[model samples]
Each structure stands twice: as C-alpha cells, then as structure tokens.
Target: MIAYRNAIQLGDWIVTTDNSGGIGEKMDDLVAVPDQITARFATRVALLEQWAAGAEPVAVLLHNFSGNASWHRYCEGIRDVFDEIGITMPPISGSSETNMSLRQSAVAVTLMGKQKLESSESTGDWYTYGTPLVGEEVLTKESEIASLTVLDEARRTGLIQRLWPVGSSGVLAEWRAATGNPDCDAASPLDVTCSAGPATVVLLQIDKEKLPNAKRHFGTLLHALR
Candidate 1:
C-alpha cells in the first residue's frame, strides 16, 4: 500500500509518500495524491518558495515502502519533473521491507543540482590495499605489495580515481615500488597528485568498522568532483 502528498511553494514543489506503517499492512494498498502533488507539496512546505527565491537547494528525505521496480519508476518520473524545473535534486537513499517481520531491502536514487556538500575537500583519486598482520609476515608483505600495484594502476588509468587512506602501508609499499622513490609519503592521510590532469587524489585507510561511514565520506568526495 502507498499514500502520497503534494505541494508547491511559489513555483517549486515536492511529492512524497506516507507509507510508514508496517510494510505488510500497506503492501496491497494504493492511495493517489493530487495531480499537482510535487508542486503543491513543495509550496506548502516552503521548499519551492526558498528555491524560487534563489535559496540553496533543499535536502529531501524519502523512504520507500516497496522495493519493487514500479515504485522506483514512479520516483524517477517525479525526479525528472524536478530536473526540468531547474530545482536542485539530491539523491534519496533508504530501505524497503516486505513485512513487519521480514528483512528490509535498500533502494537509492541519485539526484542532481547545485548544493553545498560537507566533505568537498576530501575528493580525489583513491587507491587502497591491505595485508593482514599474520604469522611469517615476509610472504605476506610480498603479496600485499603486489596487490597495491594493482590498486595504483587503477588510479593511474582512471578506473578508480579517488583516494581514502583505508589501508596506507599496503598502498605506500606499492607506490614506493612503482616510483622507485621513497619520497612519496604514502603513510600520510594526505592526497597525492598526478603530474598530468586530475592533480591530487585523497588517500584513506579503511576497515570493516569504517564501512558504514563510506557513504557520507564518499559523498563528500563526489561533492569535490563537482
């Protein structure tokens, strides 16, 4: 089941759903919002007023009740309309569930427009490599160095162009071996630059506990790209 609402502020608008009840209870239900859903809602909430008056783009949070493709398509349609109207669109990320007792599935949609991003400076090319500190570290070091080379090459060729120091020593060993110079401070959580076009890349050393934080961290990296 799905419920919706719409509004407009001056000229801009928003359309949202009210599907907060347990997933099973609402799965088969469908409720239609107004035709000018996006516009009316945006206006009612003052989102359009702010945007039309040249205010910075607003951050929108959307939680989907169903993880089906049809729901995603509907969201896309609304996003397309917003894009045509020149409003800044930010990506919506959330999870969907089948029932109250069922596991949840996640869904995400990327929105575009001009807006301030928090982690802008952290954007850059990234290369990562890691080696478990186990017994007889000699063989591990050799294997780790080889793996770092692969990551370094990915950065050089632009396949993986952002840097986060999730694993520094492993990465540095590769960088040091590749350049044949120990001057490159691969240990530092600083960005490294390529002499050519995309100058500097941010390096990060990440592990399991840091995985959940990647989204926000990477979001900042992407903001820098823009």
Candidate 2:
C-alpha cells in the first residue's frame, strides 16, 4: 500500500497505524530493553504517521499482544512520549491477547490527528529523511529509531511538502508505492536498502530550492533523492 501522507489523507484528518513486531522476543527483548523505552519508540512511530498526514496528534489506540508482558508498562511507555513532547495525550484504548499466552510480544499503535487542508502549500521534490534502518539494525540500534523531531521543525520550516514513514518494507519500497514511478531511481546518497521497521526514518518530499533550509531542522539526517 502507498504509505505515509498519501495513504492516509482523508478529509481534514489523517489516521495512521504502525506495528512494532515481536516485542519481548526480537525487537523487545526484555533483557536489553526497558519498559518505557519500547513505549517511547512506539509512540514516536504513531506521531510520525500522524505528521505524515499533515496533522497534529489528537488520540492514540494500541492493539497489544500480551505475551506475558504487562499492559500497564506498555501504556506507561506511550505516556512517556506525551510527557516529553509536552502534549496532553488523547484517550488510549485497545485489545490485548488475554485469551492465550504467546512466546513473543507485539503491538499495533494507531494515531489520529487533524490537518487544515485549506492552508496546505504546494508540493515539492521527494526526499528521504534519516537513514534506512531495518532487520537486526532496528533492534541493535534502538537509539536511532526515536531520535528525530516530532513535526515541529518540519512544520516550521515550511519546506516539507509531505512525509512518508518508512516501515518494515524500507525506504525504497515505500517510495515506489507512494510515487509509483517505474523509472524512480532507487540509487540515493544514503543507504536505502534497510527497513525502518516501525518509523525510524521517513520519506520527505520538499522543494529542491529549500533543501538547504531542511538541514536546519533535520541536521545531517536528511538525504536528498534524485
């Protein structure tokens, strides 16, 4: 499916859902992970998805696979993100795998937001934000996943035409699906072969002339796409 901003835009609001897979087993190995750490990452992904739709988050819904883990810890994780970003979180609710025990933990996070389409700007060239991170990299390098801005800078810059969070399918895949250009060159200045899993990185479409200004917010993380 076409991802990020394009796949979500519905009327004046955008809703996006992201999944953090195999929690407590692969990505969420309790031994190496903290209770709120995964929750922060999960919350970040939800925000990015909402931002991609040019919207500010209004609510969050989670679908968790219990797998012997505490639902309270997961909720606390999401709460941590709200505290850090200084936004009162909306109602949070979802179903858990209470019927059966599982070997691994997982979560499906959904975020809802509203965007004023009437104030939208013109479109621009497509670019990828942050580096591609997938597979073992996602788990091994947890710091990279939630280390970017939550949309304040992007909105202020007024350069970002739109955004697409690179998920398990990676940057190249999401780009093709979003733009659908058969001749869309995959060769990029940054690594595009990895998967971000949740939303470690994203596809940013912006005007070429404003490329320099984008760095003011994204720093060295932004990669240009031809």
Candidate 3:
C-alpha cells in the first residue's frame, strides 16, 4: 500500500481510516453524547477525507469497543451520514468488543474507495467552507458545520479545484500542509489553532475568476482564507 495524504493506494483502490474514543454516553467517557452521534461524527471524518481526495467509497469497516448494546446506535450514525450524502449506503461490516466491559466509547471507521486519476492540475486561491468548531460547540452550532451536499454540488459543478477537510490539527496546520507553507498561519482569518472537530470545515481551492460564482453558490458558508 502506498500512502497519499491520509489515504493509501492499494492496487486500484484508495483507503482511509479514522477513529474516535472517549466521547459517548458511557459513564466514564470524556464527553456525554449519544453513541450514535459519536459514531456519526467519527465516521464523518473518515468519509470526508475519502471524498476530499476524490475517492468513491465502496466499503466500510467499523471497530466498536463500546459494548454490544452500542453497535446498533453506531450503525445508525454511520447510516445517517450516508443518507446525507444521498449515496446508496455501501456494504458495512466490522467487529465489536464484547468480552470486557469498557468505561468509554471507542470506535474506528475505515473506508475503501476507488481512485480516479486527475488529468489536470488544480489552480486557484484558497477559501474556507465552514467555521472551526469542536466539542460541545459542534452540537450547538449545527448550522455552521459544512454540508456534504454542498461539497458534492461544488465538486460536480467543477467549482472546487481541490478540497481538504480540517480535523483536530485545526485550520492553520491544514492550510500549511495544503499549501506547503509552514509559516503562513499569520494570514488566516479564523482561529488558527482551533480544532474543527469532525471536519466541520473544509479548505477549498477555486480559481479567483470564479470567486463570485463560488460565493454565490456557497453563500455564508464560504469564507476567504486570506
């Protein structure tokens, strides 16, 4: 397997994996949220990474450590995201740890997708497609979270030259990684160090000439990174 960004290339497929822990309805978990929500957001992060890299997900492997009772809720969360993206849910399979009682929730999602070769280079200026949000704020600022439908629309319309979902490393770190400019965080408009939680924000590169159209398309969800 060859690693490209967070995904790995295996034969003709690209695979990406992400995991979450300690944030569920379990008594000893760090955050008291539903297992479904925890699984949903965790799955969202991995899925966003796959989609941003231009992969069509075909399979999912879920790792559940929360207990047998939490398995259905986690699956529900996984399905919720698939429904949001309007894709027929892919085949899902995984394992659950039922031998020992766990104090916290732990889950992992791995997506395997087909890779499509890019014929041209992406040329454009960078922009942010959502605000940075984390923790309890993610629940409270639901509207600020980036929408998968919007991302799909932008990609279909050729408005998004490239896409990068922001994770726990926050916007600045991702911006630097995306641009190969380690010191460019000084120019960001949002909190450079704030975690985006479950990819609540995405970095988009669009041609400057198309900014108006993109702005019109994305509305308040888009913010200039500069």
Best-fitting candidate, measured by TM-score? 3
Q: Write the per-residue lDDT of candidate 1 for residues 1-226, one digit (tens) a residue.
A: 0001122223233232222222122334232322223222222222322221223334544444444433554355445545545554555555444454323322222222232212122223323333322122322343332122333333334343223321223445434543346675554332332211101122332333434444333442321110
Least lDDT summed over 10 consecutive residues: which range in candidate 3? 1-10
lDDT of each: 0.31, 0.67, 0.84
Q: Write the per-residue lDDT of candidate 3 for residues 17-58, one digit (tens) a residue.
A: 888888998888888999889988887888877776677789
Write down the TM-score for model 2.
Answer: 0.79
Ranking by lDDT: 3, 2, 1
Ranking by TM-score: 3, 2, 1
In model 3, which regions exceed 4 Å deviation?
1-4
Per-residue CA lDDT of model 2 for 1-226, tens digit only, reads 1225433767776787666655544453543455455666777777876666657777788787754365678788888877766777778888788888765567767887886434345567777766666555766866555354444556555667777778767777788876777567676886676667667788877777887877676776676776
148 Cα displacement, candidate 2 (Å): 3.8
TM-score of 3: 0.94
- Indicate the worst ten consecutive residues by lDDT in candidate 1: 1-10
Position 37, candidate 2: lDDT:
59
